[model samples]
Target: MIMDANTIKDELKKVGISINDIYDLVNTKESYPLAIPVLLDLLQKGIEDVKIKEGIIRALAVKEAIGKASPILIEEYHKIAKDKMMLRWAIGNTIYVTITENDVDSILQIVQDDENGMSRQMFVLALGKVKSEKAEDILIKLLDDEELTPHALEALGRLKSKKAKSKIEILTKHPKSLIKKEAEKALKKIG
Candidate 1:
């Protein structure tokens, strides 16, 4: 079912959370397109374990719920993104957006997880999104990673960084056909 503001309101009310914390979220004014408004509608409320978990969960869902985000909404999105499952998904989505410098460590760890292959895709996608000069080394490191090389190469090419050129120069010579193909394509594009 499509969740409406009423459901969010009800959930917040369950834990005695007043919309005061998120008055802006509920404001119905301005052009906030974020899934959940930038308010601690659930987090700042007084509640115990159950509520805390529920609050985090509800807060987490906002990332999926939103279709667009204002700067305030994006800030709120990243703050709640500290939640694990939610953060994972958010990084996957926001990897390309202009991220705050502080968010780099955690998101980079997502790229490094090796265990979660999907995260490599997310990390690559996010790097392509950010297109930051800082991500060049990590993108190049993806070249050496036996496990994550494919996605990393793809991200590197998509990023098309001048720094990425050296790595692509090397990857184009790699033994794997798929990797070589992608590297060649990236080289052609960036050339």
Candidate 2:
């Protein structure tokens, strides 16, 4: 059954989460085990506000509820408008925080699409957290993307890509401290 806003609000209220607005339901701290289902329900079937959806995505992450929410989050990621930067960023972060082996291919697809732009940075980092040869290869190639070089360096490091070590070493001398630092860190991880 598709829950109306009032029904969703009532469900949250039963869990002591009194909210005057839907976006107010984005709670990061304090595990609301009772409210998770409601939030998930709302995320799946409730209002269409990108902000509220973004909030729900972030709240789910903070609650460590990604297992139940990951598929829905990925679906939402594809359905949302490209201009919804915050929500896109939230989904990327959710992937980063709760990445699993099953998600490697999906994450690779997202990162490969340059249309997703920098919003895919966290997804790049997520690739590093898992053991995937394809993901490692992609990260190595992404090192050429100036906007994403730091994230690519970090991911390649996490994968301990020996193939990327020489390229990463070059980045250590990059004038930008962030890139240089990421390059140095990746070298350590690769070692």
Candidate 3:
């Protein structure tokens, strides 16, 4: 069924139709286009529900509505300081969808402030999606972090950085098989 934003909003008001159900529907390509505008509207209303906010963010990313969603996501990021994982994932998805130079500094700041390894890893991967020299430098620095190195290497590979080639080669002999495999793949990508 082809639903407009108003119709979707009404459906959401129904008691049993939870946000997760909306999320599942919006995750599909056919439904995402219809869902994104409504999701953005809900976000704009300042919905306090964390799950709803996350669902909206994911819907925006899945629909590739970065241009329309980035500003709102950044605003939400600034407002949400306690939910580190959610913020990181939303930012990562935003970066992945739209690798703009304007967002690089903010993303770097988030990476610097976050102490969680997984959040840092997600942010590092997001940084790789940015096609800026600054992002490349940040990825290089993260290569020394044992916990983040594998993800960093993967991001560098995605960025296709020739400067990371030597370092990635060194990681090919890492004791951890996952790191070794990722490093080998990164080397190939760099080449």
Cα-based TM-score, every candidate:
0.52, 0.84, 0.77
Q: Which candidate is the best by lDDT?
A: 2
TM-score between model 2 and native: 0.84
Q: What is the C-alpha lDDT of each candidate?
A: 0.53, 0.79, 0.70
Residue pairs in clash, model 3: none
- Arrange candidates, best TM-score first: 2, 3, 1
Residue lDDT tens for model 1, 1-191: 32344555565566555454333343334333333432234333323333333343334333333333223323443444333444444435543453444545555765666654543465465565455666667877777775667767666667676777887888878999888888888787677
Specify the poorest-scoring 10-residue window by lDDT in model 1. Answer: 65-74
Supply the global lDDT for candidate 3. Answer: 0.70
Candidate 2 segments whose C-alpha is farther than 4 A from its true place:
1-7, 14-28
lDDT by residue (tens digit), candidate 2, 122-158: 8888888888888888999899888789999988888
Which segments of candidate 3 are over 4 A away from where they belong? 1-8, 11-20, 31-37, 83-87
> Which window of ten consecutive residues has the lowest lDDT sum in model 2?
21-30
Runs in model 1 lying further than 4 Å from the true structure: 1-34, 38-91, 94-102, 115-117
